[model samples]
Target: MKIYIEDIAKYEGQTITLQAWLYNKRSSGKLHFLQLRDGTGEIQAVVFKGNVSDEVFELSDKITQESSVEVTGTVKKHDRSKIGYEIDATDVKVIGESVDYPITPKEHGTHFLMEHRHLWLRSLRQKAILRIRHRIIKSVRDFFDNKGFTLVDAPIFTPNACEGTTNLFKVDYFDENAYLTQSGQLYMEAAAMAVGKAYCFGPTFRAEKSKTRRHLTEFWMVEPEVAFFDIYDDMDLAEEFVEYIVQEVVKHNREDLEVLERDISKLENIKRPFPRISYDEAIEILKKKGNDTEWGADFGGDEETLISEEFDKPVMIHHYPMAIKAFYMKQEGDKAACVDMIAPEGYGEIIGGGQREEDIEKLKAKIKEQGLPEEVFNWYLDVRRYGSCKHAGFGLGIERTVAWICGLHHVRETIPFPRLMDRLKP
Candidate 1:
């Protein structure tokens, strides 16, 4: 009878056929111990010389690492086994022979592993991280679906850039120029007016030239837009959304957490009502910490770390200078005051959002002030031209949020296939 790797624990004292790849092997004369992995889990199989035929014993002895094989064995309950179950092999047959596997049971550098990512994904650590990433992605959709948010897909190809033209991947669209989307914010806003609340979760491209841990040329972003929502409501939604994702990871990915060696205690304190501070207040704190940051300047990486470390929960830094922000953000008072939120524990700003200027005239003026072509954004400006309300939304980088929850240093490992400035292949 054929059985899966996970079902081996329940089939004790029964004969079963197992198909898997030989992860590792140990042979001591007549006794053989083989660790087999079949994607679901790993199990130890013991093949004694007397328990199997001569052909089976010889095949097990000569089987190379990662060789695909099938074995008929009797399931046995072994209390001393690491995986809580073992298989006593009675018959073994090689299905596919793998000669000179590139990845051995030894350590390799990051560059070398990335070059061999096709096979490196089979390793225990890489497999665990990717599995956790899948869970995170699932939880994101589930959360939004549970809420009344309609899923709206934005276009991958756009006639004009959303942020700026400097970091856009220009492609020829039958004589006209098209660029990949850097954020789905503008599209989601238009959808929100139609659906009340809408979100776009997909790949966003940015042709950034520098190679930084946080910057990726192409990455997944989740942008949610809500009609009739202000900056306060935006922060409330952002906090709750973050808390939901972190709690989901803690509840479902215990085994993965163990593999990553994450200190669960740190994540345990990540509840809602995270610490809130104004941009001006954070600047004062930075200056006290000897950061030398001015009120008009955006928070640097060092300043962000110091501010986030002061609190146990994620910090919500609001009312950033409008002069340094996007043209769409609604200006507060006479000076520059727009809302932004930053996560604690040095994760930096995972969300950038604010109340968009509802008045079409003011928005156009701001666009011109920022030196952006008003003609290219006429479609976006249409949202305000007709029945516009005080609406707000934020863009959350999915990779950054996952990296923070998993306590990973680099964002590349959060995604299965990361496209950085230097890497494009598997």
Candidate 2:
């Protein structure tokens, strides 16, 4: 029977055929050890000259790295194996031969590996990262689904910018100008008005010229909006939502985390009630750290990193200056009722959100104050005009969160194909 490497333990002691590729291989005097991978997992296939026919033994010895083959073997229990199981090969047939694969079992430069990212995914480390990423995505959906939040998709091609026009990716929408969405928060607000609680999960684009490790030209975001929710409610939800995602990943992707060498202890400690500090307090921390930051200035990468180092868990900095925040954010006397959740270990801010301004006149005045196109937001204002209630939401960057969870230094490896300012190839 045909079997996948992940289910090899179920057929122990039975001869099964595995459609796999040669991941690596080595040979002793009369025996060949072929490292095989079938996408689900990897295993060592031992081919002995005395146990198998001469043809099978010769074929196993000559199989190159990444060569596709059908390996028929007895699934033997091996207590000391990395996967706790091994395949004793009885026959092997090469379906295709791969000669000189670019990504060999050696260290490669970041640029070289990025150029070959299409093929580089087959590597064990890359495979593990992608698998963990899959779990993260699934966990996100499951968390919201169980919490009674409906999935509402936002448009990729937007009529106006959601965050700001400075970093917008503009496009020619036939006769009128359009832009790729920077966030789905605004559309999600409308969905929440109709559905009570809703979220949008999709790709967003930003035409930023930043060359930092945390910046991506195009990335995925999950924005959750809830009607009749206040700033404090938003903070409470953010903490619980993040903890749920981290715990779910730790539970399901333990083996993948081991492959990535992530410290599970750090992830395990991420529980509800994350440290929440005010913006004024965060500024004091930055000043004490010798950073050249002022109270009114927005926090950059350096500022975020210094502040996040104060705690082992994610930190929430709230009550930012109104002038520095988005126009839709509600005002608390003199400050904007907004929050930014900085990830621990210098990963920077993964979540930014606040209670939205629900008053139609205040929303319009803020739009005019920010010098935004008033005509495009008429529909947005209509949401407030037609019985709008207090609402709150937050957007979480998927790549940044995945990088932090997987203990990766950069965001490029978190996604299958990352679109950066300079990269658009395979």
Candidate 3:
């Protein structure tokens, strides 16, 4: 019977054949130990000369790393293995040969590994990171799904920018100018009016000329918009949403976390009631930490780090200066009802949004003041024109959140293939 390593425990003590790749191997005279991996998981298959025929033993010894093979063995419970199971091989058959795989056990430079990202994913650490990323994505869908949020997909190509034109990738669309969607918030807001709550989960592009650890030329974002939601309601939802995802990851992805050497205690401390402060309060904290920060100045990576350090959990900074915020946020005198959720340990802001302006006049005036294409926003303004209620939403960066949860240094490893400002191949 054919079986997967991940489900080997269900067939323990039963003989089964595993179609796998030779992840690695070693031989000690009469015994050949083989590390086998299918897509689901990896396992150790011990081959004894007395159990298998000479042809099987010779094939096992001759096979190279990543060579495809069929390993027939009896499953045995293991106390030390990460998967909690091992295989006692009775036969081995090589289906394909791999000659001198470029990525071996030896260390390689970051650039070299990136250049070979297609093959680099076969490594144990990369696999662990990707696995945890899978769990995070699933957690996102489940959290919103249970809360009755509709999964509304937004367009990738837009006639105008959602955030701004400065960091947008303008492209020729049949002679008419177009740009990649930077955020799905605008479309999601419209969807929220139709449904009570709505969300969009997909890739978002930003033609940003940035080389920072937090920046990605193209990344995935999950934006949730809700009708009849105020700034305080939005903040409350953000905190609960963040706490749910973090706890889900911690509860389900413990083994992957161990593989990444993440500090589990830190993740466990990501419980609810995250600290919520105002923009003025955040500036005060920054100034007390020796930063020459002044009012109305937007927070960057360094400033976000300083503010987040004040708490062990994620911190929400709301009521940003109106000048620095987007045009659609509800105005509160000199401040806009906007919020940014900064993660602890210097991960920076993972969630950004707040209550949107319900006044059509204010939306149109802000669009004109920002010098945006007024014609393109006519549809957006229509949302406020007809039966508009107080609405709010937030967008969370998947790559950055994964990096923070896994304690990764860069955002590149969070995705299967990272598209950065410079590197984009394999």
Candidate 4:
């Protein structure tokens, strides 16, 4: 019967057929050691020359790296194998042949690997990263689902920008221009008014021209919004949300973490009650670290890193300057009631959210002050006019969280087929 490599351990002592690819091959005078990988996992298959027909042995010798084949063999418990299982192959059938694959076992440059990203995903490292990414997404959905948050899907094509037009991707939409959604927080707010607690998870776009490791032209975000919640409630939820997702990934993807060589201890320390410091306190910490930062100045990547280094876990900086924050954020005097969760180990902000302004007049004036077309936000203003209560929400960057969990250097590796500023093919 055809089976996957991940479940081979369950069929021990029984003959099973696995449709796999030859991940690697090494042969002795009497036996051929073939490393095979199917999508689920990898296992070592030993083909004894004396036991199998000469034709089968010859077929094993002719198989090349990444060649698809059906390996009929008896599963055995092998404690020394990487996957804790091995197969004694009695026959080998090549389904397809692969010759001189561009991505070999040896390392290739970033540009070359990216050019061949379609094939580069076959490597174990990439597989492990993507597996963890899947786990992160699952945990995110589960966390919200269990918390009574309804799944609300936001529109991809928006008539206007959520924040500003400078960083939005404007596209021709039939008769007029429409921009790709940059964040689902605005829609989540409307959903919150309807369902009490709501969330939206999907792709987001940014047209900023940045070449930094943290920048990506397209990425995914999971935003949660709740009615009758204030800024402090938002911070509490953010703290619990971050802690849960981190621990969930660590719990379920331990093997993947091991494959990535991530420091499990670092992630284990990601508990709730994360350090919450006001923007003023963060400025003090940065100043102590010899940063030339001053009050009311927005923190850049370098300043964020310096501030986050003060704590071992994620640090939440709240009460940012009103002038720098989005107009939707509620303001107290000169500070907006917003927060940014900066990840440890130099990973910058992974979440940005806060109490949304619910006052209709204030919201309208803020929208006009930001040079936004008030008519475009009439429906949003109606949210306040019809029935509006205190509400808050936050948007978490999925790629940055994955990169931090996997201890990756760039956000590009966190997602499959990442869209960047310059590269687009494959």
Candidates in order, TM-scores: namely 0.96, 0.98, 0.97, 0.98
Q: What local lDDT does model 4 show for residue 215?
A: 87
TM-score of 4: 0.98
TM-score result, candidate 2: 0.98
Native-to-model Cα distance after best TM-score fit, residue 55 in candidate 4, in Å: 1.3
lDDT of 2 by residue, 1-426 (tens): 457988988999999999999989999989999999999988998999998998888888788999999988899999878889998888999999999899889899999999999999998889989988898899889989999999999999999888664588889999998999899999999999999999999999999998989989999999999999999999999999999999999999999899899999999999978999999999899889999797799998988889999999999999999988889999988799999999999999999999999998899898998899899899998889899899999999999999999999999999999999999888
Tens-digit lDDT track of model 4 for 1-426? 568888877898999888989989999988999999998998999999877999999999989999999989899989999878899999999999998888888879999999999999999999999999999999899999999999999999999788975588889999999999999888888999999999999999999999999989999999999999999999999999999999998888999999999999999999988999999998888888899888989999999889988999999999999999888999899999999999999999999999999999999889989899988888888889988898999999999999999999999999999999997788
Instruction: Please report, as a residue range, the 10-residue window in candidate 1 with the lowest summed lDDT.
Output: 334-343
What's the lDDT for all of these models? 0.85, 0.92, 0.91, 0.92
RMSD of each: 1.5, 1.2, 1.5, 1.1
Model 4 whole-model lDDT (C-alpha atoms)? 0.92
53-79: candidate 1 lDDT, tens digit per residue: 998899889999999989889999889
